[model samples]
Target chain A: MLEIINLHARVGDKQILNGISLQVRVGEVHAIMGPNGSGKSTLAQVLAGHPAYEVTAGQATFQGRDLLDLEPEERARAGLFLAFQYPVEIPGVSNAYFLRAALNEIRKARGQEELDPIDFMDLAEEKLKLVEWGPDILSRAVNAGFSGGEKKRNEILQMAVLEPTLAILDETDSGLDIDALRIVAEGVNRLRRPDNATVVVTHYQRLLNYIVPDFVHVIAAGRIVRSGGRELALELEAKGYEWLTEAVPA
Target chain B: MSRAILQDYQALHPQGAPQAGWLGRLRQRGLDRFQETGYPTSRDEDWRFVDLAPLTGAEFRVGGDSPAVRPEALAPYRYPGTECMLLVFVNGQFVPGLSDLGSVPAGVTVGSLASITARQTELLGHHLGRYAPIESSGFTALNTALIADGLLLHVARDVQVPRPIHALFVTAGDPAGLATHPRNLVVLEPGARASVIESYAGLSEGAYFTNAVTEAIVGDGAVLEYLKIQRESERAFHVGTTHMRHGRDSRGTSHSVSFGAALCRNNLDVVLDGPGVEAQMLGLYMGRDRQEVDNHTSLLHAHPNCSTREVYKGILDGRAHGVFNGKIYVTPIAQKTDAKQTNRALLLSDHARIDTKPQLEIFADDVKCTHGATVGALDQQASFYLKSRGVAGPLARKILTYAFAAEVLDEIPFPAVRESLEAVVMARLNARGE
Candidate 1:
């Protein structure tokens, strides 16, 4: 569902993601394990069309459409969703109202009738259950004063409601506990199906134990230095990334 | 109009007038003060940032006895729900035929200042311009001199009026070189609580000037919630001043919203004289095209143990300019006073500008006062966040601006006002092609 060829991206004047290429097919979960400053987050930001990340040289295609040319919102409407590593805190806007507005935007783009408040509430309730979230989070300001675990779970809840074809989970397990991590991974697993895909980016192989991936790639110096099977994540966790970077010919 | 105004000032301020009764003496004294002060200039400290060039050069006559606008023409100014009392003014003249006070509670008195000149004359005598300074304020004095009639409302002691009183002011006839003045007096007796909504709207397509003043007195332990909304034609010029004095233990809240005009300036001042008095001053403005709006607010803590809060926000589009100056004063006797203020603006265009100033004068060392100001475009990061959620660019801007204003609007406790204000804000935004 997604393809990248020699992606070169930068945050301001400093280039973060060098030439990187990867592909994820339908019904497959691609796990990218990298250490800090490995450009794993940069890849997700570039894919999400973050304005701060300029794609200087890259050819990214999603569902047969060129992705780099579209604006962030256009890319989102074209079936792309990024679960932010750190969710933004939007004060003065109720979580429920903001989420509904987002859902309606996506629905409207699909030539579908927008969901009224009643229907929206029903859908929101069902989706909240995916992450074991409750109605209490609905009235609170968007992610304001939210606990780390609650923020992670809220990201999953938004994904379930948006139902993007290509979902990129950017360090969703970073600040989550074991229980919260499992709930988030399970939510992703439930949404998985043929003709759709998920990409899980994490620093550790812990979250991999919950949401199994068909392929694993270790990113270093902005490129995927190694590609292996699902067991490769465990092998890297055991050996660490020092040898991987050393193995890359200097 | 200038000649007539100068003539009246001369008549009101002849020498030896102070030797007469206190009222006559005061008027004569005020006349002399007016002669000495004449009119405020931008060079003055208080008017340093205010540009009165448009009003200075313009020649305008006092609004005369022209027939009121048709009822259908005033339909847009009406509000829904039960109105305890309604007052309508056309060209500064009271319109009793257009007013309705059937919903007022028993023992509450609501009448036109022109009609009940006898019974309310004494009450008006004691508190006319004494609560404010008309000598230095050209618009305030002009309104006082030419004001044909206005509103006088008194709520009995301890009575809580469940419904709000609506006051609508409209100007008729082409305003080629004419102006109107309307004065409103509102007094909430001891322990009485009420809400008043005053709207200044225009029906004429001409450039009329509306110079109005509203003075309010909150009796001991009384609570007053007042909202002033201004929606004038593009060619109109509006200058308004509101003076409020809170009695001991009384509470006052004023929310002012303006949609700009050719030239609009508002001076809202409050004096907290009684202990435990609390006051809240809030303002918001949304302007498009070449409209300009300037708002100045002052709060005085005269006695001990008082609290005050102020928040003002503005959204400027095209070449619109916005100005905000808020002053908070704490006297030596006003120990334990707590004051806070914030002014923020969103400039939608490169040329749009905002001048915000917060002045605090504290003679009491035991008081706590903090103020903040900011001017910026929409948050680029927040806009991107919403865009990534599938919302379009224009919709994203609307959401951000709405959230910015919601900081003040959300804290309102009344649901009806909250909903109505939301609708009004949304409609105003949509009118700007949002």
Candidate 2:
């Protein structure tokens, strides 16, 4: 479902991600773990088409489309979703309204009929329960005054509502409490399908226990130094990235 | 040419030096003040950010007549889904045929200022020109000097009008380049409550001027909600001033929304004369093209235990200019006063400009006063968040801009007005193509 070949990116004159390659087939869940400033988040952001991150040299394909060539909105319409590590707080815009706009835009792009307000609310109600949130949060401003846990849950709620073909969750487990982590993982676990894929990027092995991944890759100094089965996550959690840093190419 | 027009306007009035009553003296004093000050230049401290050349260079005659316009022509501007006591003024003259005063309650008077009877004149003599003195500003002086037709609202003591009173001033192009000064007087007796909406619009494409002044007196324990919607023609000019006085334990709210006119300026002043009063001033201005919108607000805390809050926002695009000057004065006797003033501007284009100045004159020791202003472009993070959700770039910009303006727009208590203004703002944003 997703492929990346020798991806290189930069911010301003400083290089961030250098020569990183990865592939994920349908029905597979992959976890990319790294230390602080190890270019793990940069890889996810570059794939999502954030304008601030310049792609120096890279080629990425999602569902047989050139993901790197599309705009951020166009990439979204092509079934590529990026759950931001820090969701922006937008005042005066209700969560329900923002979600409805997104849902309708995607629907229109796929040549489907748009839902009215009543129908949209009905659809949102089902997704709200999946994330263990009430409908009251939807009427409030988008992420305004929401707790860290609620914000993380709201991102997962959006993911459930949009039902993207591929979702890249960057640092989704950073701010969640144990209960919030379990709920978020449950939501993501419930949405899994044979034709969809998810790429979980994190620093710790805590989230891997909830939504177990099929593959775990340890990234250090902008390169994936090791790739192994899910047991590698448990090994890294016990040993930390100290051993992985020495294994990088000098 | 401008001086000649001013002289001709004075001569067109009744051929008398001055009458014997206070109203007559007010008119004469207004003329004297206007003659001495003329139009304010940018050199003045209050007018530093505004250039009056475009308004002063044009010659606009005093208007007292209006051409015939169908009633259906005003349907688009009417407040939808609300049955308001509508007062229509065409070229500064009240049109009885277009006005509907059937909903006015007993002991409440809502009609044209020109039709104020001798009996009602005595009731308004104390509050008419007291709050909005002509000597305060040049435009107020000019409006008072040439005041022709406006609304006269008098709510009896302890009476609350259930329906809002709508005052619509339409500048018809009967005589092109016409100017009209409409002076409104609103007197709420002790414990009285009312909601009033003042709207200014143009009936034709000619470049006209509407100089309006509204003086309101909120009696003890009275509550007043006032809204001003300025939607003039693209080629027209507008200058409006609203002066209000609040009594003990009274509450007053003013919402000023500007979206039209080549050049528009509004001055809103509120005085908490008695103790335990609350005043809130909210404003929103959206400008495009060469349009310029300026708003000046002042909240005077004269007594103790009073509070005032102000929020004024501006969105400028396409080289438009915006100015916001907010001042809060806490007198020595105004102890335990709470005041906050915030002015924010969102510049959509590099050439768009905004000038904001917040002045705080606090003489009281036991008071809390805060003021802040921010000017910046759209938040890139917010934009990217929306765009990544599949919303187009243009739509994302529009949504963010609308949200920026919604903070002030939400302060409006009328739903119909809010919806209409929201639509107007959306339409303006859509006009700027992707």
Candidate number of the best lDDT: 2
Q: What would the TM-score be for candidate 2 when compared with the true structure?
A: 0.83
Candidate 2, residues B1-434: lDDT per residue as tens digits?
25755674566455776454766667777778888888888988998898888888788877645778689888767885777899999888899999887766997988998888466768667777788987788888887777656999999999999999999998775546788888999999889999999998876876788889999999999999999999888778899999999999999999999998889999998999999998889999999999999999988999999988898999999989999999899999999999989989999999999998998999999999999999997878788898889987677988899888876787788878887887888788889987
Worst 10 residues of 1 chain A by lDDT: A241-250
Q: Could you tell me the lDDT of residue A70 within candidate 2?
A: 92
lDDT of 1 at B325: 95
Error at B18, model 1, angstroms: 16
The per-candidate count of clashes, in order, stands at 0, 0
Superposed model 1: Cα runs more than 4 Å off: A3-23, A30-43, A54-61, A64-69, A84-161, A169-190, A200-250, B6-36, B66-72, B81-84, B173-176, B303-305, B332-336, B411-421
lDDT of 1 by residue, B321-395 (tens): 888999898999899999999899999888888888888999999988999998998777778778878976677
TM-score of chain B of each: 0.90, 0.96
Clashing residue pairs, candidate 1? none
Give a tens-digit lDDT track for model 1, residues A29-139: 999989898999989989998888988897999999999989899888888999999887776677888889898989988989999989999999999888887888888
